[model samples]
Target chain A: MEDQLTLGGRNFSSRLLTGTGKFASHTLIGPMLAASGSQIITVALRRVDPKAPPQDNILSHIPDTVTLLPNTSGARTAREAVRIAHIAREAGCGDFVKIEVITDMQYLLPDNHETLKATEILAKEGCIVLPYVMPDITISHQLYDAGAAAVMPLGSPIGSNLGLEMKPMIQRIIETSRLPVIVDAGTALWSNHQPVCPPLYLRLLFQPLHLLRVQCGYRLSQNPADHE
Target chain B: MNININGEAVETSTPDILSLVRARNLDPSSLVVEHNHTIIQQAAWADTLLQQGDTIELLSFVGGG
Candidate 1:
């Protein structure tokens, strides 16, 4: 069991990297993070809460144990993705960057062309680029050659909870790539496993948490100490 | 000659790696060189060949936040 994964010289203890987009409130996010036992927390660089006044800083509540993983979510092109990475790096994110060039809003699929080009460029620029690409073996090889620190291949569309749709390719990627391979996006198996929240906002939610439970359960049961 | 960085004009001369970087007047620590869109490793920068019309983008990783 790999307890901590090192990317670009930074050590992270948690394998579970949780996204902060869907959580109802900042108050809940902290507890959920604790519940999830995730050390790596993903945050979108483009979307900042604007309704709150400027004086109120939203980033205060996030615990220090959480290793901030700033993602390039909204960018459509390689240039735009690089620009976002630059801003995040400048904003004290250290050298880590999650490259996600999502061109389709509905599918939330990464634009393969843009992703490869950007990863190559950023790797040259000295930023540790972890790209979220579709399950393409050729792209994976190109990414490794391009100097990516890691490859995050989507299981399904973003937020779809479709666990490892491209199973064979993902397994192949995991086997072949020298870098850490994280199965990112569409791993929403939390609805059933974690029990339904009593809140009205979540009442209509039909998310099946069982998928997430199995994934976490297998990981935790195999090596409980790894979770620590 | 397009531009002279240190003292030597940018030319097609296949100079030694140290001489090439030295002629460019670039600090190896501050800047990263990407020639022809491929990132030149810090260790290999001196040995990397500089051709005429080679598109180089210099990137600086500095402190922020």
Candidate 2:
């Protein structure tokens, strides 16, 4: 497994990047990370109570082998995202940040306009900015120009788990963009062991999540690591 | 004196950020401080004294995505 996915000047053999949310507990994250073999894990920043003791903190659970990618999930605008990035780095979380700006409460879609603004600001400040945007080629190019590390296009709305619904647009972006196209959201599975997302589960599941994401019509990109 | 820390009112007599960190049993190296909307660097924590009616926000990365 010499094949590696490089981001922010670092190489990751395990292309999979898993999330800390939607899990049973912080303890489960370790085994799930082991099962998935993800080199990178994403977490969100929240305001903690001053009186509460930091016993089961997420940082204490994550293994030191994996890199921490703190996402700006609560941000509604670019300015707020930038602020969070600074706070994350200052908190010793390092420079890796996932810029997620969502204003649409109904669909929970990523706002590309504000995302681009935040990317430009944070990337300039030496943060590896990975933005989650709608599957649009033009906006992907803009984000690349804004110094983004990778263009993370959503397969569907956040938490929808309707994997790669925007197949045509995501394929177009993957094919045309010079930067790496990361399929970020819309990956969902059921607790009952039922296959809620059919296309992805059927077509691609044996490999890592970052590799072999669904493009138009269950097609696998020629090179799983390089392409979307 | 009373000060706001992470939105909770705390009555502490800690003279500076170092003392405050010690008082709260917080690892001085593990947390970042935003005192009144400005990020106070770790090096300045000792000199950055706490004051009455001052607002201090301590933020740390947690486990959620």
Candidate 3:
């Protein structure tokens, strides 16, 4: 029984997905990818700066073996998100698109309604749509009905490093969803000795729990009190 | 003719998308060209002529979350 994560008719051995952002230098990306063993990584698209000095192409740093998950991070509406998805695919980023429609600048929470709208359109267009959204069971069902490949519920706000603040909602989503429930953001738990663990350690700590849940048929105790 | 590239108006005599990209010293292989809201593949860049007031968006992959 080989464990693999399937998305859009493609199989990936690694369950951990990493982002290519917030790094001090682009040179570290290749090494990071090699060390983390992440099969899929997220990237963003933006208008090329005309005045800036020529820089190395980001794609060159990424290995061909890894899958690129281009996100619609700057989109504020479904229409904008759909446009970005088309652009990303046409740009040779593949069919995998992470719909991230966010208008709330303060909290950076995803707009669930707009995310669902984009997911419905992109999935129909034959894209492997993975929508990032707040943890909500109703929207999770809606995303499934809209042909989403998986649902990515945030553990907390994006980049907050608060760890599973929305644990209860995420657990509910996991319990009910037929699609894969990927906990997307706010994963860096606080540490006493260090501010946060290295990215590799974070992945190592997180992946086993995910595997355990999946291996056990997701049969965690249903009762909220049972968790205590 | 004057055309918009990435929301900035530029005056250029470059005839096609390929020439325009070269004139700006941009790497064609690393770019995704959107001409008037529709994507233009690299193979089609030479044939895609630029016109006055045409909106061209030049985009590329960047590190982001």
Best by DockQ: 3
Best by TM-score: 3
**Candidate 2: what's its TM-score on chain B?**
0.89
The CAPRI class of candidate 3 is medium
Q: lDDT per residue, candidate 1, A139-216, as tens digits?
A: 888898999988888766765555557667777776676767776665434455541222211123312111111123
List runs of model 2 lying over 4 Å from the truth: A50-55, A189-228, B7-14, B17-31, B38-47
2 or 3, greater by TM-score: 3
True contacts kept of each: 0.00, 0.56, 0.80
Q: Look at candidate 3 and give me any clashing residue pairs.
A: none
Q: Flag clash pairs in model 2.
A: A44-B64
The clash tally of candidate 2 reads 1
Poorly placed runs, candidate 1 (over 4 Å):
A47-56, A190-228, B1-65
Q: Fnat for model 3?
A: 0.80
What overall lDDT goes with each candidate model?
Answer: 0.60, 0.74, 0.79
If the candidates were sorted by their TM-score against the true structure, best first, what order would they fall in? 3, 2, 1
**Local accuracy of candidate 2 as per-residue lDDT tens digits, A30-148:** 66666556678887887755577764667877899889888998899999999888888877778999999999999989899999999999999889988989889999999889999
lDDT winner between 1 and 3, please give it: 3
